[model samples]
Target chain A: MKNYLENINKAFESRARLGIMSVLMVEEKVDFNTLKDTLQLTDGNLASHLRALEEAEYLRVEKQFVGRKPQTTYYASPAGREAFKSHLDALEQLILNNRQKD
Target chain B: MKNYLENINKAFESRARLGIMSVLMVEEKVDFNTLKDTLQLTDGNLASHLRALEEAEYLRVEKQFVGRKPQTTYYASPAGREAFKSHLDALEQLILNNRQKD
Candidate 1:
């Protein structure tokens, strides 16, 4: 129970943050537009959330010109990946514990 | 990636609801007051959330007398347990997929 609560709680510390982290957890890197579309978020909204993730050092943002247009791409940093892994492990332990109770 | 997004999204369909589910994912049965304390929720707030979970058939509530006072305890239903397990699996697959990318 302790393990379950700790993991789910950690994984859900921030709702939007978790969504972004979950997406980055799988994709090597995704463009800002792609993230915005996948999440159905407004430009400003996505940018703000991305900024928060960047500040947390959970993600890295790369900005450059893509065919003369400014493009930004995001990727999960090592720390971010580790945090996501720990969070998932906690959730798994919780499920296993529950099954044992049955 | 598809698996990770699906699991995290389902696990977090509702913030407060997820919290309740996560707690019940372990412990066999928990009393209302105990749940309240663990979640730091008000009586009314807890009751409302409990009612929602009850309606979802995700939990079973038993009302009985403990000594002289009425005691209400909650446990996850079989279906609820299955749902939680599926959710955890999704999260795990997501983590594994991410690790494979490294």
Candidate 2:
């Protein structure tokens, strides 16, 4: 069965992943160490999540050398923005639907 | 490692559960049918998620007889409110932290 809710992107169901998407949604792109420090995530955990999003093709990765040091940057792909938008729209709809009860 | 982010409740990470909380957070209380209609959730799916929150003690349920029929209403308990607040704070912090890059 194809559930409409399933399209909301379970990949971002995790707070960490959702946070990463939220960050990328606004910023043009963000680098690794900044994402780590900003999100207060451990190297392993952050990298793991980055890989997950990367594999999902929801994120665009740019590998560059900054002063002879490897620096990786992340961006939300077009599909990623669409998925996140749908996810947020689902949330907003939920909130909107319940407003009469509020 | 006891990461501070772990303190954020994972229970409401799902959109459905978070929607439930967001509804209860504002409404004094909501009944089963209302929640179902508002969330557009199936009976089994809604019941399971409700059970998950109930088990977490984040939700308060009041059962009574309305016209000889059983009626169940849900409320967000104080602890549930606190946990949800912390979760939202974490989200806000993530957005806040990334503003510099945005």
User: Per-candidate DockQ versus the true complex?
Assistant: 0.30, 0.19
lDDT of each: 0.72, 0.78
In candidate 2, which residue ranges exceed 4 Å CA deviation?
A: A1-9, A19-52, A60-78, A81-102, B1-7
Q: How would you encode candidate 2's per-residue C-alpha lDDT over A34-94 as one tens digit per residue?
A: 8888788899999999999999999999999999999899999999878877775554444
lDDT of 1: 0.72
Query: How high a TM-score does candidate 1 get?
Result: 0.69
Return the DockQ of model 1. 0.30
Candidate 2 C-alpha lDDT tens digits along B1-102: 124346557898886887788778888899999989877889999999999999999998999999999999999999988887777655444434444344
Candidates in order, TM-scores: namely 0.69, 0.65
A1-102: candidate 1 lDDT, tens digit per residue = 433555554433454566688788778899998887777678997888788778878899998998999998999999888877776666567556655665
Chain B TM-score (each prediction, in order): 0.74, 0.89
DockQ of 2: 0.19
Worst 10 residues of 1 chain B by lDDT: B6-15
